[model samples]
Structure formats: C-alpha cells, structure tokens
Target: MLSIGELSKRTGVKIPTIRYYEQMGLIDAPERSSGNQRRYSRQGFERLSFIRHGRELGLTIEDIRELVTLSCHPEKPCGDAHHIAARHLASVQARIAKLKRLEKELKRISILSDSGHVGECNVIRSLSDHSHCETEH
Candidate 1:
C-alpha cells in the first residue's frame, strides 16, 4: 500500500487531481489508514496511470469513464473504444483543417499589409473588411 503522496508521485498526478478523479468516479476510493489518511494499492496506481494517459490523449472524462468500464469486462467487444478513438480523430482533423485556414488567412493579411501609419493600415482595413478574406473565419 502507498500513501496519497506516494501515489501522486508515482502517477505524476497532483493530490487534488487524484481526489477529483475519485469524486468523478474515475478511480475507486482508497482504503484509509488508522490515521484517516488515504492509502492506495497497486491497483489504484495502475488505474491512475490509465487515466493520466487518457487525459494526455485529450479523452473526455465521460470517454475515459466508458473506457474504464469497458476495461473491467474482458469478454466485452472493443468496438466502443474504437468508435471513441475514431470520433476523437475526426474532431482533431477538423481542428487541424480550421487551423490551416487561419494560417492562410494570417499569411494573406501579413503580405497585404505594408508598414504604414495605423490610420491607413492595410491590416486594419483588411480586418474590418471581410471581403478581403476568401476563407470563412
């Protein structure tokens, strides 16, 4: 068994975040020592590791919950996990596409702008006049 500090250190998750995960039901509540301090098992360590990796991958809390639930049933099909991953991939791709458009727009604006007074700034005029942009911001 490990203390809360030990678990936090091992998992690289903060103490409050560990408590928040417990509150969110992402992790099971740990057993308490006679002093009423939380004592975690190796199982907690593994679960927290899983949660940290999921968060790093930008998985939603609910998505992580579903994955955790699915993990508990070894006999269950992994189609749900695959679906979650696909959905996330699609979202990421959409954001990438949007960012590319923004990049093009910024480049266009920068190229159009000449070093002039702010009163006659091409950048300001282009920003005010949406017709200057071909992309839908």
Candidate 2:
C-alpha cells in the first residue's frame, strides 16, 4: 500500500488533483490508514497514471471516463475509443487553423510603421479600422 503522497510522487499528479479526481469519480477513493491518512492500493496508482496520460494527451474528463468504462469490457470493439480520439483531433486541428489565421493578422499589423506620432501612426490606424486586417481573426 502506498500513501497518497507517495502515489502523487510516483504518478506525477498533484495531491489536490488526485482528490479532485476522486470527487469526479475518475479514480476510486483510497483506503485510509489507521491514523486516518489516505493509503492507495496499486490499482489506484495505475488508474491515476492512466488519467495523467489521458490528460497529457488533451483528452477531456468525460472522454477519459468513457474510455475507462469501455476498458472494463475487454471483449468489446475499440471503435468507440477511435471515434472519441478522432473528434478531439478534429477540434485540435480547427484550433490550430484559427491560431494560424491570428498569427498572420498579427504579423501584418506589426510591420506597420508608427511614424513617431500616434495621430499619424499606421499601426494605430490599422487597429482602429478592422477593414485594414488581411484576415478575420
């Protein structure tokens, strides 16, 4: 058995986050020691590790919950997991595209000369008028 602190150290998950996961039903509540301190089983360690990896991959809590449920039935097909990953990938791709557009607009705005006076500054004029932007950000 491992104490909560030990579990956190081994899993690289913060203590509060581990508690939050327990509250969210993502991980089981660990057993307590005789002195009332939390003691986690090996299963708890593995489950927390799984959650950490899923979060690192940008998987939503709901997605991870669904995956955990799917994992319980080892005989079932893995198509649902694949579908969830595909949806998240599409979302990431869309965000990347929007970021690229924003980057382009910022680059265009940054190159304008300020002319040493706000009244005659191309940068200020461009900012005041959205029509000057080359792309919708």
Model 2 lDDT-worst window of ten? 126-135
For candidate 2, the lDDT comes to: 0.88
lDDT of 2 at 42: 82
Q: What are the Cα lDDT values of the candidates?
A: 0.90, 0.88
Task: Name the best candidate (by lDDT).
Answer: 1
In the range 75-128, model 2's lDDT, one tens digit per residue, is 999999999999999998988998997887678777766556877766667668
Clashes of 1: 0
Model 2 steric clash pairs? none
lDDT of 1 by residue, 77-117 (tens): 99999999999989889889989988887787688536678
